[model samples]
Target: MSKPLGKILSEGKTKKVRETENSDVALLEFKDSITVLDGEKMDVLRGKAVINAHISAYFLEILEKKGVPTHYIEFVEPNMMKVKNLEMLPVEIVCRNIAAGHLVKNYPIKEGTLLNPPVVEFYLKDDARHDPMLNEDHFLILGLASRGEVKKIKEITLKTNRILSDALKAKGLTLVDFKIEVGRGTDGKIYVGDEINGDSMRIWEVGTDKILDKDVYRKGGTMEQVLNTYIQLYQKLLGKMPPIRGTKNE
Candidate 1:
């Protein structure tokens, strides 16, 4: 018989999740690094990892309180989170509220157009193929997820959009769009997985198209500017500033 696997479940572009031997909980370690354009662009912005870790934990906790299932357990350290170990699905779910980014480039819609009844998209979570778009049929054919699972994912994702959109509105920000990952838990239930931070979403200041998310960094903004913007957004959302690490407060 084959031996049981050891620790270190998986690693991504900016984070790694590890499971202790004989434990069902995993520790997610966020790195002080950023990647854009499928990681063709990269840099390390001090304090970013900690800020994102806190922000993601805050959002996940809020969602959980709202009855949304998630893998998030608790924030363990400045750049680490303790979470439920999950068998992650190979798909990325995206919910868009405003026409921006690839929506404008791929469609005839103008930038900033309100997508009434927000758009939900599914993409195969393969970095090598740049996460190609997939439809329901595609998913079924590829065995990525069952029809029931897809339905459940969409339901949870839309509910999440409503909750986050309203929450951000109260903070004078617009939830332009966001991406989330999902996974199956030991209980055989799917839950929202991965980090939900600035990097996963496009946030803009209310009433204006002032970018306040990773888009700023992707568009050639300075590291200081990116960090400051993230701090400002986090403060606005949580009503307090996150502690900085390895960087001076701006």
Candidate 2:
């Protein structure tokens, strides 16, 4: 919202990466659009970009404070953040603390089962291929990541899970499961990249089955309903809310 950014570097279902003046930096612009089922379904909701921009930044900021490496730099008002440029890994690291979705669907595990020590898994980020799950060998053999890189990412991913889970628990939300993308930074270190908003994770009200994340959208909830849950999450997680549009702040 300052001077305009350069051409778009890359784009996806819910965000865009734009070139920045600094070669080592990228301007991440959040989109109002939300998608699921590997983008088989999509919708745009007003104010979604702003909500996700702040929510994801808040989560990554928490991770950075707890000694996790990340690409987060500074958030731009409305719907953008500045972040370190890096070579992104073509895989997603998922950590599940509660059995749900694919965890229960693909296996004999029951939904809502609390996974002890949690379950960490990897999947190739190929939407055309339905993002098939991958093991360390598949990751290595395909030259996606080295064995040591895999081990290192698992450490970071689990640590991220604990950090985020505890943070949400204090706000009376359950951290069900989440997916994250990693990238090698200019410093030659692995840094969590992409975004970590509700769209990339699941949340349920503590002690109840009330859903507070994107599952509502995937399960046929209306746009207004989907955003209401996300707004509730922002209020509880950050203890603050952006001023309502058409207000003084607007």
Candidate 3:
């Protein structure tokens, strides 16, 4: 097995870290714990780490097969992956395949509006300000990204969404909405960062408007149960067994 290189630099809610061989790289440990309601509550959901790793690994594998540029290298275990430590852009790329939630609430669109060409929105990643929406000009004015970089990010984001959405649909899951974060590596190559989980997606029941994904949490579902449902749905879609992990509290 390839040994890790450096010391862990930072950690996030979904992933932990250890150093990798590369100075600008690390091993990301995707924990079984989950947070929701904007990190207001958390739970150590049983088997979550394993399920998350499997889901992400499977998705990234598909993306790579479909020729998307990402930071995935190799899986270390049920809970870990080898990846580059990237300098993240303080923005979130939101891609909507079908309209619901805030989109329906904020716009005059119907609930199940299907966007022919996926709509992409950018948001400032400032939690304190609730991640306010921004435009391409905001990126230039804030000096957060060059015009060229912004264009590149947009192009890649759209391509990523298109490919992933099609792939998921083939597996009977509608890729309603999802978020992406981009970052720069030591060589200045832009790659995707962060875990793409149920929290980052807005999946819905294929035939009904019944919601799945993070909307469950928003709709008052318990953290543990909601995340488990997500894992189960993902596993069903991928036609895989749910890897068993931590024991559930009786």
Query: TM-score per candidate, in order?
Result: 0.93, 0.96, 0.88
Ranking by lDDT: 2, 1, 3
TM-score of predicted model 3?
A: 0.88
Where does the lowest 10-residue lDDT sum fall in candidate 1?
Answer: 1-10
* Model 1, span 8-51: residue lDDT tens: 67788899887755478888989888999888999998888888
Q: Number of backbone collisions per candidate, in order? A: 0, 0, 5
* Residue 204 lDDT (model 2): 91
lDDT of 3 by residue, 1-250 (tens): 8655445567777778777657666788877667764567766666677777767777777777887777788777667788777888989999888887778989999978889888889999876787899888899899889888888888988888887777767866688988989999888977877767676887766676556576776777876767667766666566756657432421
The true-versus-predicted C-alpha distance at residue 98 of model 2, in Å, is 0.6
What's the true lDDT of residue 177 in model 1?
99
Top-scoring candidate (TM-score): 2
Pairs in steric clash, model 3: 5-20, 5-21, 6-19, 6-20, 32-49
Looking at model 1, residue 147 earns an lDDT score of: 89
Order of quality (TM-score):
2, 1, 3
Q: Runs in model 2 with CA error above 4 Å?
A: 243-250
Please list all clashing residue pairs in model 2, or write none if there are none.
Answer: none
